[model samples]
Target: MRSRLHSPTVRLRRLAAELRRHREANGWSVSETAGRLGWRSPKVSKIENGESRRLSADDLDKLLNLYGVEERGEREALHRLAKEATVQGWWANYRDAFGSRALPDFETEASAIRTYEALVVPGLLQTPEYAEAVFKGAGLTDDAVSIRRLVQARMERQHILFRPPAPHLWAVIDEAALRRVIGGREVMRDQLQHLVNMAGHHNVDLQVLPFSSGSHPALSGDFTLLEFQDPLDQSIVYVDTASDVRFLEKPDEIERYSLIFGRLQGHALSAAESPVYIRDIMAGLESDDRE
Candidate 1:
């Protein structure tokens, strides 16, 4: 399990949540649990909160024992999860390119992804050249190696599209994103073409939220809603900011984002008409080139 290429971020979080629930169920406070286990309060807090960078199977065993989880099946299942939690995804090597395992980890287990981008193309749909321009433009780093690694990491995240039972991806991109020529005309052209091609995939739904639609929801910034296949896993909103990655998991927050995405989908072009909209933009770019 540790040898697997993908990070078990979801599994780790699930285990943490489960441990926290068990502890709370027994009426043991964090400090009480730590005192019983002869560990620091922060140590217990970190592991229970899924903030631990590395979790030991031994520690998990101790936790299971403390929580009075006796059933063989239940204990074994959790033990297996704890073991998988130690495994790191391929992106672990490119920490500079991508900070923290948050996004990649959530993406690993997401069964459906809803994205709304106002300023630029979604990373999954971006061409290599376009990705390079985005990375440089964002001022991530001037170093060539870091930029290359970042682009490669972004490209690798698209593999989920081809995986068996590919996750359903519905992307609502602003009209401005389609019109903006990033990395010059050739790059923008290729990027738009790729989006058109990807739209045809059975699991992919692409929409263009035209400028003519006027103002609507999601003016704050870009965000992604990740839904998991498992009922135990909670759906989450990933807010991507210039400085930090924020995750919203509260019931109200999830409902709010879900409604916003639905509204965006309603206002955007239909799946069938999106390609037409894109082709028109492509032609406009061509006319500018000719002039």
Candidate 2:
């Protein structure tokens, strides 16, 4: 049975895929395999699906034996994967802020992140004040403490961009998001300046999709596509909605989103031109403040 208490981490997912592969290679159906091991079918399903909290060494050994996996090196590798899957990531410490969402966990391991934002700055690029404004705007809660906690969690997530071998971030933001004046004139100004500074980062590529771009492929909404260095950890597309977040991993879905993101980049202002466009908007905000 799937355990809500234990959300699947990437390592766990990788291990699960390996287990499923081995079972398929053995040509044993889930029911047939469970029958051989005296396990209920769902128990085998849980492990293969990465829904189990943790797979004990004995259970893994039994499955390996059942699959005729006799190589000492292969056995040790699978055992190590099982052990690693049970370990919690740093994001687990902020459960109150993130709940069951696993985006941060995956972002920590992504080698490249391509994102399209229709109505706000991407979390990784948001300033503390702007982030606070966003949370407040969402009306997610009235509790000040909760808002602060959420903002803190967002700021912490940005640490990945500064770490060694940082992931490349290519963000395409719609013009409406930039003109929305998210945290009032001053906050918005500072936020724009922050964006200008971040755009200069070697790993960050910021592009603006102007209003003139007109009805684009991603007009449906915002989404992020995360790619990993490891072949086993396939690319995933993440969509965040008001009520729930969806992680799409199917090959077709990945391909579709990838094509959409490429089109977004194409429609957006070039990286060199983006900063100039932003500064002009900042100039307008400043002029309005003067008036």
Model 1's lDDT to the true fold? 0.87
Candidate 2 Cα RMSD after full superposition onto the native fold (Å): 3.4
Candidate 2 lDDT by residue in tens digits, 95-121: 898887668878887889999999999
Backbone clash total for model 1 is 1
- TM-score quality measure for candidate 2: 0.92
**Candidate RMSDs in order:** 2.3, 3.4
Model 2 poorest ten-residue lDDT run? 1-10
Would you estimate the TM-scores of all the predictions? 0.90, 0.92
Clashing pairs in 2: none
Q: List where candidate 1 sits over 4 angstroms from the true fold.
A: 1-6, 24-42
Give the clash count for each candidate: 1, 0
